[model samples]
Target: MNTTQLERIHSGKGFIAALDQSGGSTPKALQQYGIQEDRYSNADQMFEMVHEMRTRIIKSPAFDSEYILGAILFENTMDRTIDGQFTADYLWDKKGIVPFLKVDQGLAELDNGVQLMKPIPGLDELLKRAVERHIFGTKMRSVIKEANPAGIRQVVEQQFELGKQIAAMGLVPIIEPEVDIYSADKAASEKLLKDELIRQLASLDQDVKIMLKLSIPTETNFYSDLMQDPHVIRVVALSGGYSQAEANEKLAQHQGLIASFSRALSQGLTFQQSEDEFNTMLAKSIHDIYEASIQ
Candidate 1:
C-alpha cells in the first residue's frame, strides 16, 4: 500500500467523485449527459461514448484534488487512456486525485429481500491488474430492500468477506450495502443493517481497515458509531435516488460522513455546454459537495 495515498484518503477534507458507471447503468448516465441512446449502435460504441464523457469531466479544471480527494473508475475506463497515460495514472499523476476501481460484476437477483453481488470470476486477476495500474482501492455494491435480519446479515457478510479478499491484495475496499431509500421499512432496515455492519466489522483482524459507502440514513447521525469505529477508514454517503440538493442537505447533517456520489456528482453537466459553462457548473458542484463533506 502507498502510505501517502492512504493518508490522503484517511484525512482528506473533500468528497470522492464516483465516475464508475458500469455497463448496467452507462446508458442512463450518458443520457443525462445529453447523449441519446440512438447515438450509439452497439455496446462497444456505447462504452466509447461514455468514456469520452468521463474523459471530458476529468480534464476539466474544476476536477482537482483540492476539493475532490479521489475518483472511482469503471474497469473499462481503468484500461483506457487519457492524454497518453492510463486513466488511473492521469488521475493521480496529473490531477493529484487518488484512483479507485469498481470491481463488482453487477447485482444478482433479489433474494431474502436483498440483492447481493454476482460472482466475480476474474476478481483476483483484476485486483492484480489494478495494483499494477496504481489503483489505490476498489468499490463493490449490494442492496437491501427491507428490514429482514436474515437478508441484511447476508448482505454485510458478503461485503466483509469480499472486503477481506480485497484487503489481502493490498487495496482498501469500499463496501457499499445500500438500503433502498423508498423501502417501507427504510428506518428499520437502516437500524438492522447498522447492527449487522458493526458485528461484521468487529470480527475483522486488527490489521484490516475498510471503508463504508451507505445510503443517507433515515435518521441523522444514525451511523455515528460506525464512523468512529477503529476498523473503518471512512464512512461515505451515496446519493441513492436523491437529487444533488437533497443529497447534500442530508449529508450535511452528519458531521463525519462524506459524499461518494455518482449521479449527483454529474448532475447538471451535459455534452452540449461550452467548455467555460461546463467547468463553471462542475466547480459549483464540487464546492457544494466539499462544503457538505467538511460539516
Candidate 2:
C-alpha cells in the first residue's frame, strides 16, 4: 500500500515470492539457468526456511551487505498474515533496494485473518494515516450484477466508504479494474470499470491524490493519453509467474517495473528443492534482466 516505495522499483523490475523460502548463499539463481545448476538443491531439511533464506543472504561471503538491488514481496500467499508489517519493516530497514508488495491476488484470506486478530482496533487513525500516500490494492471488483441504478448505488457506496477509509488516512487507494483474458466488451468494459473507480475516488472528495492504477489494459491506447500524466503511472503486472519471453516483452515496452506473483517459481527453473531455492531462482531471473539492461 505504500506508493512511493513501489515507484522506486522502476530501476529494476524484479521478481518476488514468499520471503520464507528464498534465503541462501548458493547462487541458485545462476545455477537454475544451467550456469551453475550443479550447485542447487531444495532446502527441504531446514526448520526455519524463510529465516534460513534471510540468513544466507545477510551473511553471504560474496555480497558485502544485504543490499540487494531489487526485492519483491510476494503479496500472494499468507506470508503477510503472520507478519503484515514484517515485509514493510524489512524494506524500510534495508536501503538501496526498491521493495515492492504485490497484493490483491492472495490478500483476501490474509486480510481477513488480520482483521480478526485486531478487529476494530483503530479505524479512524488507519484511515487518516493512509490518506497522505498511495496505498495500492490489487484488483477489486466493485460492481453489481443487477442492472438497477439502485443496485449500483449500493455497491458504489461500499467502494466510496472504503475509498474514504483509505483517503482519510492520507493514502491513495489504487482501485484497479481488471480486464483479464476472459473479459468481453473491451471498451465498454473498461469504461464501466473506470467509472466505478471514479465514483469511489470522487466520494473521497479530494482528500488524497486519485490515480487510475491498472494492470495491462486491453490495449495501451486505453490509457495511452493518461500514461503521460505525472499523477498516473501504470503497473505492468504480468501474471503466470515469470518467463523469459514475458520478461522480454515487458522490458521492451513498459516504462514502469513489471510485477509477478505466481510466475517467479512457476516457470524456467529446472530443479527445485526448497522454498529458498525457489525464491533465489526468482530473484536471479529478475536480477539478470536488470543486469542485461545495464550492460
Index of the highest-TM-score prediction: 1
User: TM-score for each prediction?
Assistant: 0.98, 0.49
lDDT of 1 by residue, 1-295 (tens): 8888888988988999999998879999999999999999999999999999999999999998999999999999999999999999999999999999999999999999999999999899999999999999999999999888999999999999999999999999999999998999999999999999989988999999889999999898999999788988889999998999999999999989999999999999999999999999999999999998999
Tens digits of lDDT, candidate 2, 14-110: 4332222232322444343333533434543332333334433422332221323333443221233223344334444533443332222211222
Worst ten-residue run, lDDT, model 2?
Answer: 109-118
Candidate lDDT scores, in order, read 0.94, 0.38
Q: Model 2 off-target regions past 4 Å?
A: 1-85, 95-160, 186-188, 195-204, 210-213, 228-244, 247-280, 287-295
Say which candidate scores most in lDDT.
1
RMSD of each: 0.8, 9.6
